[model samples]
Target chain A: MRRLPLYLMLSIAALMVLFPLLVMLSTSLKPLDEINHGSLFALPQDPTLAAWTKAWGGACISGTCRGLSVWFANSFAIVLPALFCSLALGALTGYALSLRTARWVDMLFAALLIGLFIPPQVTLYPMIVLVREMGLFGTLGGLVFAHTVWGLAFVTLLFRNFFLSVPRDLLKAARIDGAGFLATFWHVMLPLSLPVCAVALVLQFTYIWNDFILGLTFAGPGQQPVTVALNVLAGSQFGQQEYNVNMAATMIAALPTILVYLLSGRLFVRGIAAGAVKG
Target chain B: MQRVHLQGIAKSFGATKVLEQIDLTIEPGEFLVLLGPSGCGKSTLLNIVAGLEQPTGGRIHFGDRDVTDLEPDQRDIAMVFQSYALYPTMSVRRNMGFALKMQGLSTAEIAAKVADVAKLLQIEHLLDRKPAQLSGGQQQRVAIGRALVREPQVFLLDEPLSNLDAKLRADMRVELKRLHERGRRTTLYVTHDQVEAMTFASRIVVMDKGRVQQCDRPEVVYAKPANRFVAGFVGAPTMNFLEGELALLSDGPALRLKENLLPLPGLWASRGLQVGQKVVLGLRPEHIGLAAADDVGTCPGHVVMTEPTGPDLYVRIRLAGQEVTSRMSPGQAPSPGQKVALELDGKAASLFDVADGQRLN
Candidate 1:
């Protein structure tokens, strides 16, 4: 067939991407001795759940044998509140800016867009100083605040662009129907923003859950997230490296984000392309 | 019903002037239509009246209550947009009842009011359907029903029928006129379609280039336009124009073109015209006819083209080195390139001065 070359190229590209994930899965299922004697890409000869059990419960991380359970709980605590705060503030700000009341409003939107270009690493020092001044430098609250601030620009940009494409006459009709700002937003605009909200939710959830630098810096003792715990478990520096437990911990830490993408991947794609074309 | 009054209304967007010193009053129960071509600021004037856009310099009153500083909801007026603008997410009942619900009326009362309007609009069976599920005509009726349920003091429509097919537009026009007769609200309508204006409006305000050219009844505007723009903008198959000088012939005064003369015998529109004064003669297509072959006072030209509809024939004539069109009965249509004697009826013609395009008589 004429399409044989195309299919061959696609299969090679797909295998290249799936190889590391396959290795992680295989290594996590093998016993310690089998992993030590086998090739990195080989399948397990005798599969066991011992490595998974230790990764979830008994592995030593940061001078404790309690494993990743507490840290996994900590990630949920940080991500849920941070995601809520960022999405709410972003939606409100984007709705207000979409009204296009004056010249200064456009200038303000342009200023917010500038925030998306500067790397978060560039602002890390200023953020640390600000959080220290607020008396929340090492607490979970400070981590939530940092994540919300870093994510605000992206979420707001998504919502504002989507809301701008709404027909102006809809707003006028709502006004004539006696709906004020809050009422119109609740009854009209909010219902129409479902796809955009789904995109923001999935993205912000994955970002906060997978973040390493901010979690390692701001999380106090006994409050570190799963990513920080996974790093400490893999690089203990004192014990002989247990490669199987480390791989299992890595897989457990990544499961939430993978599940999120699977659940809402179609909506994410649709939302990204929402306002680029009109019907 | 409330009488709507606009005084000294003016609008300028940054540096571009949109409307200039527009003043008008609509009596209670009167239908006043603002008729103009696109970009002539008719819709801007309507938006100013609706309290949707504030005028740069003006005061508006609805029955002695100044509403210039008020928001649209506070002004007690309803509008039907060109797009119909029905809420996409709501059912037809909810769309019509939304304003009443905002007023904090009970659910039972809102339902009753919505039902009454739906029944009147003959959309009772579509109460549960969303706007996207309906056809264009149904959406238009729902839009009107939404406005009607509010029972506001003033009603405004901005080219509401422009998006429909020709037959649907004509049918809706009659329906809207009947609705106006029943409700008798002080309504302001804006459209570029002259037929809609002529049929629906109690008084039509003809505007061009952001200025009011003529404000009168439909027949007067059709018969005696105030200037050249109003005459050309308001007619179909467009009024034919001939630039010439007035000459006093042996029988009477006549418009003298290059090697051709059209007799202007005792025409009221040509009163006080001095001999040899430059003027433009405007004649509608139906006013020119095929004269008897041997008639003495006729201008002769060859037919350039012929367009035949069922009841009428429009023949393009090449006369005096210019092309002119004449509307005749289908039975009287001459073939192309045939010589025809044309008769001009000066009684219905309008004479405008060549210098300023203003009516001379």
Candidate 2:
């Protein structure tokens, strides 16, 4: 067919994008001696689950021999509560702001927009002092609080713009139907915002899951997330690096975000498009 | 049913006055429609009555209970929107029952009320379907059913049928009229469509530039519009306006157009018509008809165009240096360039003072 060349180019582009993952998979499956002696692109003649198992549970990470499992649990602990708290607060704030036409609401929204543009590093010192003042510094709660605070600006912006597109008459109708503010939001606005929530969820999940500096600074050693643990495992100074274990560990740390995207990719695209077009 | 009274309802946004000094009352079980062109502030007035928007100056009362500062939920009102505004995520049953449920009604009571409304609106089979699954007309009925389930003291609708197709709109109009007849609820409807206002309103409030021009029975508003604006706005193919001055003809007082003197009917003679008084002639298309061979008070003209709508023909005539339309039966429709005489009924025609646009004899 006439489209053969276009298909060929697309296949080549896909291969180029997937090549690094393929190499990581090949390197992770090979034995240590084979990896040292053979080509990087070579398939493993005798594959093993040694590196995966070691990276998951047995390898030393920052003088802790219990590998990424504890830290994986720590990441989930930080992410789940942070995600729930931030999304709940963000959606409510967005809905409330969308209903009012006062000048103060717009000024407050502008302030939130200003909050969104500042890099996390710029606020890390102040946040530390604040958290320390609250006696939450270096605790798992501190990390969750940090992530939730940083996530609110973006999540609120997303939901606020989405909520603004809803028909004003719908709100009036709800009011005339004898539904109060919270009742209308709970029954009407929340259900209508499912797509926007998905977009926020996936994005917040990725940001919180992959975070490094925040986890390193705010979390206690025992509560450090997998990103910090992965860094420690990969950069250990005493011994020769185990490339296979590091690669496998990197793969494990990145798995949840990948799966989150894969499961809800269509909805994510739709949500983004809906927000963009409507806003 | 409760009487609705809106006293001195005035609203202004910054420097722009949207409504000014609007005072009206609706008797129990009256269907009063606020009709106007776009930006006439009809919708704003309706919002103020429903307690959705606060007026800068007003007090609203429902049967002697002042509700001006009350939130919409406390006003015991229900409204149907132009877009229907149905809860898209809920089934029709839940959408209808939501308001009752909000009042802390038991499930049995809510379901009973919802079922009764659904049956009344003939949307029982659509109870389980989401709003998105239904067609436009069905969603509209569901929206109405949602309002009906509340059985509130006041029903407010803002152009509820404007979004439907012509046929569906006509059907829904009849259905809404029937529903009102059964419930006898005090209702306020806002729309820009003259036909909808004429057909559905027991009384039509004609508004322009944020002011009420005339509020009267539909038939009275149609036959004798209070001012030039009402006369021109309330009719289809819009009323034709020609500037002239009152002059004396051989038989009677007449309106003098460029070289043409239109003889006035005998009824205007006793109204103390003065000679050489300037006025604008407001003539409805239907009032200008094909003249009989020996008809008196006829203005001669030539047809410029003929528009054949299904049942009637609207002929645009070039008369006395002005273009005017004459509605005629299809069988007697004139071709372009055909010479004709149009009978202008001086008795039915509206004469407006050129200065204030107010009606004159």
Candidate 3:
């Protein structure tokens, strides 16, 4: 059939895409000796749950064997409030920008959108100093603040483009129906923006949960998130290099984001199609 | 209901003047229609009255209260937009009762008012449904019901029926008249449809180029338009104009064409016109009738085209080196190239100066 080569190409691309994930999953099940002596692609003849248990319960980091539980809680403490604050601010800012009351509003929005381009890695130094000056360094609050600031540009852009699709007549009708600014947004605009909100929440949650540099830089030792803790576990200085445990720890650290993608995939595509790409 | 007055209203957007020195008063309980083509600033004028747009320089008074600087909610005005602008997320009951709820009315009172309006509009069965679930006609009824539930000082409708189909638009026009009669609400409607303006307006204000052309009863506007633009803009099939010069016949003053002479009444010169002055003779198509061929004193012409619309025939006649249309009864319709004579009702005709478009008599 003429479709043979096309299907072959697609099958190759899919294998390439799933190859790393399969290696991680298979490697995490092997014991240390088999992982060392066997071929890289060999199936583990004797698989064990020791690495998973150790990753969940007893992986040593910072002279402690507390595993990922503490750091997972730390990430949650940093992420939940940060997600809420960033998304709330972003939705309000986007709604205001979408109103387009004056010529200068466009200029202001352009200036704000400039933040989306400059990489957060470049701004980490200034952010550290800003967090320190505010007396938030090494605290969960500091990490939350850092993540919220980083996510604001993206979430704001998404919500602004989404709200722009609503008709001007609906807003004017609300105004004439005696709704003030806040009431109009709460009763009308908010109810219509549920899909876009889901997209923003999923995206922001994954971003904040997976962030390593911001958590390691601002979180210091006591408040470090799971990503930072996993880094410490993988790069242990005194132990033999245990690739299976490192791979298992990496899988655990990435679970939330993968789950988020699976849950919000369809709505994420809809959001991108609704002008988030332009934003 | 309250009398609404817009005094010396002027609005300019970045040097593009929209409305200039518009001063009009809408009487209490009067159904006033602002009729104009697009970009003529009719909707802008309505928005200004609704307090949605601030005028560059003006004052608006609803009854005795100056509301020029007030917000739309504070102005005691309710408006229905062209799109029927119902809140998509709310049910029909909530859509109709939103203004009352915003006014902080008790739940029972809001429910009572919304129910009353829904029943009156015959939308009681649709109360639980959203706007998207309703047909265009049903959505329009709900929009009107929303405005009625507010009981505001003024009801402003901005081309509300313009989005409906032709048959539905006609039905809505009749319903709008009936609604105004039953409620006796002071209403201001804006549309470019001359048929809607002619039928639904208690008084019609014809506007063009951001200025008022004429504001009077529809019958007066139909019989005697202030200028040529009003004459041509407000009528169906359009008024016809023939260029000629004023001359004195042996009997009296008359309009002299290249091929025929049309007699003018003696009192037509009461505006101090004289012979040899160029004028345009304005004639409605319905006023021109087919005369018997070979009749004395009749202008003979040939039909160049004919279009029959079941109820009436629009026959095109080539008369005096020009093509013009005449509305005739269907039984009297003529075929193309048929010989016929044209007769004008002199008393019902109008004349305008060749230099200016102002009416002569």
Report every candidate's CA lDDT. 0.90, 0.90, 0.87
**TM-score of structure candidate 1:** 0.96
Clash count (model 2, backbone only): 0
Each candidate: chain B TM-score: 0.97, 0.97, 0.96
Tell me the spans in candidate 1 whose CA falls farther than 4 Å from its real position. Answer: A276-279, B269-271, B292-296
Q: Summarize candidate 3's per-residue lDDT along B64-107 as a digit string, tens digits.
A: 99999999999898999999989888999999998888999999
> Model 3, residue B236: what's the lDDT?
82
What does the lDDT read for residue A202 in candidate 2?
95
lDDT of 2: 0.90
- How would you order the candidates by DockQ, starting with the best? 3, 2, 1
Quality of candidate 3 docking, DockQ = 0.82
* lDDT by residue for model 1 (A193-272), tens: 87888888898999999999999888888888999999899978886889899999999999999998889888777876
Task: List TM-score per model, in order.
Answer: 0.96, 0.97, 0.96
Query: Tens digits of per-residue lDDT for model 1 on B103-205?
Result: 8999999999999999999999999999999999999999999999999999999999999999999999999999999989999999999999999999999
Could you tell me the interface RMSD of model 1? 0.8
lDDT of candidate 3 over A1-279, digit per residue (tens): 999999999999999999998988889999999989998788888888898888877888887887887888888888889999999999999899989899898888888899999999999999999999999988878888888888888888887887888998889889999898889988899877877887898889988898888887887676788998998888788869888888888998899888888888887777666666464
